[model samples]
Target: MLRQYELLERVRAYDPDADEALINRAYVFSMKAHGSQKRASGDPYYSHPIEVAGILTDLRLDDETIATAILHDTIEDTVATPEEVERLFGPNVARLVDGVTKLSKIEAQSENQRAAENLRKFLLAMSGDIRVLLVKLADRLHNMRTLHFIANAEKRRRIARETMDIYAPLAERIGMYEFMTEMQTLAFRELEPDAYQSISKRLEQLHKGGGDLIDRIGRGIRAHLEASGIEAQVQGREKHPYSIWRKMAERHVSFEQLSDVMAFRAIVGTEEDCYRTLGLIHGRWPMVPGRFKDFISTPKRNGYKSLHTSVIHDEQMRIEIQIRTGDMHAQAEHGLAAHWAYKEGKDEAARTQHPWISDLVEILDHAGSAEELLEHTRMAMYQDRIFAFTPKGELIQLPKGASPVDFAYAVHTDLGDQTVGAKVNGRVMPLRTPLDNGDQVEILVSKAQHPQPTWLNFVVTGKAKAKIRRFVKSKEREETIALGRKLFDEIVQRLPVPLGWEAIAEALRRLHLHDDDALMEAIALKRIDDVQVMEALLPGSAGKGQVKPPPQRQAISIKGLTPGVAFTLAECCHPIPGDRIVGLRREGTGIEVHAIGCDRLADGIDADWVDLAWGNESDGGTARLCIVIKNEPGSLAVITSILGNHGANIVSLDQKARDGSFHTFTLGLEVHDVPHLMRILAALRATEVVSTAERI
Candidate 1:
């Protein structure tokens, strides 16, 4: 743990105006509050907060952030209250400390839910003040560093996975490369111990074989840059293990197949020299096609800038190089923390200036669930990025594999909701087309166009996904509620007494529903059947017993006036009177009625099963038949004439494919009942032209 005076000295070295009294008070107060508590590492719990504060001091954060770090765990782990911290150190420190105290109230939830809630709390705090994120990140980093102290294997893996999924990505989002890299390394070490050990062993073997290859490459690059009068600093290293593992997984390649594992950086004095060094380096080597990117002109959303290239070096080694100015290098290394290091009010300035921070705020507004928010926020914060342009030349950055729908959403939520189509490179393209780097896109939208659920399959951006989902949920509920209302009115007519608002209120209470809409939706969805709904509305209205289905041989009433709206008859079985039926409630559309013995009903992927029965109200219904006849003249006539003799009218006829020796006909015949259709089929089967005939 950092001593009080030593911590203050570290803060004052960076910020001479830092409040030494505040730091001292926080340090002493946190130590006293923690008392004799111990960590899983068997160290004093007070030591953890002090170490977290020390980490922040290395970032050169303000004194208030350091104080917040000290008290962050005090409110959660100790008996200290937020009010006490506010009283001692003031509101800024208190607020940040409270924000970083703990993630979420994870009570009795599934593991997935708990993880989502933790991320939800973290993102909410980060949006309020970026320093909350900074402190919490430091706290998590310290916890992750000591995670091995935990005895439970599952517990350790859970913490490691959460850090890998959430914290590391978050750190990267704010331009904190050093923190992100270290967190990822620690998490990777815990999550995949075997891969970690194997990769480490391989790296060690390579290092031993190369004999200071990184230093030699760095020296060679520095020599070349200085010789060209570029005034640059060069550094080289092997790639990160996690990065290498990810590449291996993505490309399905082995370590030996990887050519650009060695990366070098050239830090130049000016922006011009950054590019000059790039040009000079390319001039001396054979450039790798499609391996160059100029982030200097189009910086990342987090404000990172650099020129990247890969080349075949004089040593005949393929290597990756990044060239940037010193200031760019600092920002790339420290990210948003660099803003606080050099200026006053930079904390708030950075929070306002960065699009990503505002996006986190925007995400909070539209998320419907914690799991959803975590998923979309991860998509927004963590991914390899691709850059594209709007029709007017405005640049848009999106995750790799993002579609035009993502581009529209990145521009504006309303634009995404109204997106109909897109034109890529001046040619009309499908909306699901994945955008390419540097592709100029034109989003074709309209006021009449609404978000479609199918877009969710293709859109990869979180903003696009959340907005589309919100719209879809709203639309489905609106339509379902309207359908429920119509069904409610129809059910009310069958009741003994007329219902009023009082009856609805009574039903809502009995069903534990919030309002009439909930009651009606439940009714439409058959969550509460007619008898249950009537009983809730008015006691004993449905009598002592619920309505039961008639015997198997008897046909009950099933009125389907609107085939596509209220329900649809399954064309495969062509159900009629005296045929048992089943109803499947499909998504988006309504239920489909299938014969009980239909082959299509055997598939397991159907929607919710609804009880269905054949109605006696119909005089007759259509039964389709598939007939294979000899390929001779008058075969079609013979089949039609036979059905006509049985008093079965041809509703429709379609010629199917013709095989070598036989032709097929799909015929829809109107019959009085199932028995009548059977009689008609018997006559058709006896014909000379009909080779095989059966009801479809």
Candidate 2:
């Protein structure tokens, strides 16, 4: 544990303007607040906060961030309140401590929910001041470092999994490679003891066998750079066990098959030298094709820059090399920490300008549940990135394997909603086409088009899927409300006396609904039927008119039309089970139902109309298929054979048109829904004698 004065001196050494008195007060206050409490490791609880504070000093964070780290657990595990912390430490430290405190207080029924709630709170705070995430990460790092001290194996593994799934990705997002790597290693050990041990033993054996190999390789790389008039410092080492293990698992390769396990870094003085060093190395050694990347030209979203390549050294050993300037090296290792370290004179507003932060906030608004937020945020955080561009040259960074729909969503939600087609590099492509690095994408959108539920099948980004789901859900709710309102009106008209909104409000409690909207939505969704609503509205009235279905057969029931309203399906368009049909009442003529989009409906027949839908019991309907086939006896037989094989019962068949060698026929068949009709059509189209097949 760091002493009060040592912690203060450490902060002062890096930040001369750090508040000494503030640090001392925080250090003493945390220790006193913890009192006699001890960690699972049997050390004084205060020691944990002190160690976390020490870690923040290594990042060279501001004084408030460091102080917040010291007092993060005060409100969570102790009697100390946020009000008291604010009175003692001022608002800045109090706010950060409050953020961390909220993250700790979220308890849920399941482990997944708990993690999601905690992450939700953390992200909310992170949006305000990224320092909240910084302090929380430091706290998580210290806990991970002492994780083995915890006695329960299951508890330790759960903590390790959460750390791996959430915290480590966050650290990497903020550009803290050092913390990310160490946290991953610690978690990997707890989660996969056997694999971790095997890899650890292999690394140790390699280290012993290749005595001074790292040194010799470093010297040779340095000598080569110097010989080419490039002054660079070369460092080499074996990759981390977790990284090596991941490579083996991903490629399904044995340890012996891994050639580029050893990596070297050449720290140069200038950006120009970084690339020159890359060229010189590639010129000297046989370069591994498709293994080089130049991040110096286009840095990562976190602002990391480097030149990476794999080369064959000594004509046998394949090694990976990275070249970067000194400043780039610091940022690559520390990420956001390095950004803050030298952020003097630069506007503080620049710190919170990360595009992902706003994206997280948007996700919070759009996510429907804690699990959804967790899944979407994880998808957003963890991905190998690829950079695409708009036709206007604006850069759009996306996860590798992302489709154009993902690209459209990244541009704007409206664009994604209205997207109908896409062009990749001036050539029209399918909407599901995966975007490649540096490709220019132009999305073609139309106001008439909205996100299709099928878009969820191929979109890789959470943002696109979230927006699409929200839209689809909203549209469904609107349609459901419309149907429910029509049903409610019809039910009321059948009553002894007409009921109003107050009557429905009175019935809400009996039906276990939240409010009128919920009740109506339920009615629209068919979860609650006309009989149930009438029973709720007028007690014992439902049993009077309810006609129980006969035992042997299931029959379709209409809800919005009164019991004796008498409705007939219009024959002009042949409204089916899946079609949106509406009820039209004419004077003394009961009612006529027509598909909403039917050309017959466009005739503007004047009548009292109500929205209608087929109930869940409505199983089968007839559909008409207009198909073209060769005008031969065997062709008609083949068509009939295909329909019978697909279980379509043909109701009627008529020859609509004929040519020299082909005939057009309109056939009516009983189908379950639009999908059944589509399958039948597809099967007919696949037949050798059929020229075309389409739904009428």
Candidate 3:
């Protein structure tokens, strides 16, 4: 039971005119709202919110942020209203509470969706103030710290997976390195307990004397800086447990391979002092080649600016050193929140100052669907970013493994829609080429070229997928509309009445369809019958309630066809069940059924053909027949006309070209009887360019 005065005192250290009355009111309201509620650990639920507030206070968040933290869990876990929060605190506090509250009520169908939705909500809230996410992150950190109280292994793993996938990366994106490392370590411990323990034990054993070593290094760096009259604060920090485990897995190395497990941060007062400290450190130790990064000049997208270098402290020892000014250090730890003071002022001015903040807000606003919003949020907030450059040298930050297609889309939807090809570092590369750090990319655009379905297979970023989908759908809609107009024209030409587009639109709307394009696309796919549209246009149509006529069955069966007998239709000459069929009874269960002109039998079977007659009843079946026809337009129409005249049903028809100006159609059809089938085959054989008509 921590007192409200104590909390206010801590908050007042950061915000001089800290609202004690408001803080106490929130504390009392939260206490009442969470009355008799308990956590998984069976502690008073109020304690959780207190801890969350304490976390925000440590971050030196403003009074409103601290108040919001107190009320964050109230709406979710207790009977508290956003209105009440707004009345008690303000709209800002209420919005934060509402943001956190929405995340608690999302009922995703699967664990993956659950995680994605949570991340989406977090991002939406963060995009608004950025403080909401900071509070939420603090909340998650506390939950993770006490996760062991939850007995279920599956629940534990789910929480851990969500933390790893969303929270940890988000922490990194915002430059909360300490929180990110802590969350990752906890998540890794839960997700892969055995591996975590193995690596953690090794790290502990290896760094047995690490505390003293870190103290000595810190002191030495501080003394060297002081001697050089450079004001700086140097502190040593070890790599988190999860980081070590990840390094081992990524590099496929044992713990011993990781030499620079501990790092020293040199915090100075000015940018010049930072560089001076870096020089002094380099002069003291041999700097490792290709191991230095100057983020000061080119700050990270998250506003993290620092200079990093790795060096060998001794012949056998490697260490990392980070040099940054006090402002840079604050920016590194607090990220976008450092700009909170500016944001709290004039709204228009705030938007102009941090335009990227507004970009984030727009991303939240213009997200068309929940899934898309979730995907964009994850990529933008919770993934490792690769910083690439446009040909103009403007830096673009994208998720790791983002393709040139992603970059094209990031530049503009119109550019992405027109992108035909891309060049990386002056070399022509595929659109799917992955960007690396510091690489310059140039996208080639063409109005003639459009996105292909295959682009979805490689594009990694959500924005790229959304733009491609939008472009493709727009083109498809246009094409379908055109096709629909053409189809309508053909329909009107063939019909007696002059039907207009509105009438067709009405008919389609009756079928629960929205527009002409949808109806036209359905017609093109053969999903909607052309005759159905004609019937709809005509008044009191007889075909409206009519069902498809069942195939007329021929009552003919082969005699002496025993049950449990296996029979095969000859490929050389296929026999339909309705065709005049003859069965050759072999010595065993294997029997051969064929149409009269089976070429294999004409050549003569290896065994003697037995005299078998047909029964009166014929089973419903189809036979394969190959027909040769003149390769000309409407040749298929002529063939279909012949079948329709005979009332023969064509099941499947496949045609392939035999040579120049000649084609072969392998026809599958149902005939009423053997005589009917025979007559049809005879008629096909007599047709022009009919090289052969055989049952096969």
Candidate 4:
């Protein structure tokens, strides 16, 4: 732990204007506050906060940030209160301390829920001042470093998982690569001990066998660069074990197959030299195909910039190289902290501004559930991103494979809802077309356009999907409320006086509903029946105003099956809208629709049969098709696209059989009628992989 005077001197070293008295007060106050407390590591608890403060000093953060770090735990672990902190240190430091405090008192639904809720609160707090997140991250880092002393294995793993899942990604999102990498390394060690130990052992053996190989590689690179008239500082080190293990898992390759285990960095004096150094390095070695990325030309969303490349040296050894200027190297190492180092005492609004932070704020407002907030924020933070542009040249960073709909949503919710089509790079493209780096996207909008259920099929971003779902849900609720209101009015048509919104409001208490809208929506969804609604409006009037039911079933209402029409059973395999039907009339029974292949019509001498077809009243009717498609990449997408083109929506698809060459899919489609179904089948049959497509 840093001593009081030593910590102040370090702070003053970077931030010469840092408030020494404020730092001294916080340091002494925290020590006294945690007077008798001991951490699981059997050290004075104040040491943890002091260490956290020391970590922040390395970033050259403002004095208040460092003070917040020192007093972060005082509110949570000690009897010290935010009010007291405010009285002593002012509201800014108190608020920062309060923001870092954990939500241990709130009763949560589950452990996952607890985590999600905590993240939601933390995000909300951090949005006001990013310093909160910085202090919290420092605290978590110190805790992770001392995690081994916890003794409880389960508790340790839980902390490690949370660190890996949430904190590491957040650090990375903020461009804190050093923090992200170290946290990931520590968590990976705890989560996969066996793999970690095995990799560590292998690394140790390699180091023992190769005497100073890293230093040798560094010297060789430095000499090569100097010979080419490029003065540079070159350094080499082995990749982290977790990074190596991840590559092995993703590529399904053994450790022996991995060649580029060591990474080297070349820090040049200027940006021009960074590229010049890259050209010279490539000239000396055989370049590895498809192993280069020019981040300098297109910086990451987090503002990370470098020229990354891989080369095969000495005809066998593969090595990864990074070339950047000294300033770029510093920014890459410290990330957002780099900005603070140059701009001291910048206000929260200026300091906290970031695309990812803006996205998190949007998510905090729009996410449907605690789990969803957690999920979307995780996706927003962790995914490898690609940059796409609007026609106006505004950059939109999205996860790789994000579709145009994701682009539209990232632009604005209104634009996404009104999007009817899109043009990528001046060419009309499919909505599911994956955007690449620098592709200019123009979303075509129409007043008639609204988010379709199918948009969810292709959108990859959490923000896009969440907004789409919210729109669909809100629209459904509005429609259901309207329907319920219509149903309620019909029920009250014969009443003494018409049941109005005012009357419903009065009866809400008796109906066990919150408000008029709640009652109406419930009635619309049939959760609360019409009779119950009528009775609640006028007490003891359940049957008085209710119309008596007809002797027979008034009208066969199967929601979407029959829009507003009445239908009788078609016994010939129950010919519904999708099946080919023939009407048959028995002696006294009404016209009955029968399927063409009904067994009852074949043997039995049935009544006279008449040709029948589904009426125009039908909106969507079920149709069955037997499809044989080759088992290959995108086969299913092709079939679905064909159907979608012909205005068919797949209700369900079941696999009947599969061979190495071909697979049979039994698909149920919600189509207009038999003719519409035939059109879909025709399109499917015309597809290349589709060997056979016929109505079943």
Per-residue alpha-carbon lDDT of model 4 for 147-242, expressed as tens digits? 899999998898898788767876876678899899999999999999999999988888888789888888988999999899999988889999
Ranking by TM-score: 2, 4, 1, 3
Q: TM-score for candidate 1, please give it.
A: 0.55
**Candidate 2 clash figure, as a count:** 0
Off by over 4 Å in 1: 102-110, 342-696
Q: lDDT by residue for model 3 over 329-421, one digit each (tens)?
A: 877776655555323322434433442342233332333443443333333443355656565444465777888888888888888878889
| TM of each candidate vs. truth | 0.55, 0.57, 0.55, 0.56
**Per-structure clash totals for the candidates:** 0, 0, 13, 0
- Over the full model, what C-alpha lDDT does candidate 3 score relative to the true structure? 0.71
Q: How many backbone clashes does candidate 1 have?
A: 0
lDDT of each: 0.77, 0.77, 0.71, 0.75
Residue range with the least summed lDDT across 10 consecutive positions in model 1: 547-556
- Highest TM-score: which candidate? 2
Ranking by lDDT: 2, 1, 4, 3
- lDDT per residue for candidate 2 within 1-696, as digits (tens), equals 688888888887878777788888998899999999999989999999999999988988888888899999999888999899999999988988987777666522367454434443455445446667777788888999999999999989988988887788767766788999999999999999999999899888988998888889899999999998999989998998889989999999989898888999999999889878988998989999999998889877666689999999983799999999998898888876765552453446555443333232333233345334333333334335665667544446677788999999999999999999999977999998988755778999999998887788899988998998897677656655655665566666656555666777779989988877788677655576666878899777667555333232222245433222134677777777778787664443434677788877756456655566777646567788899999877999998888888888998999988898999999888887777788888888888899999888
In candidate 2, position 103 carries an lDDT of 67
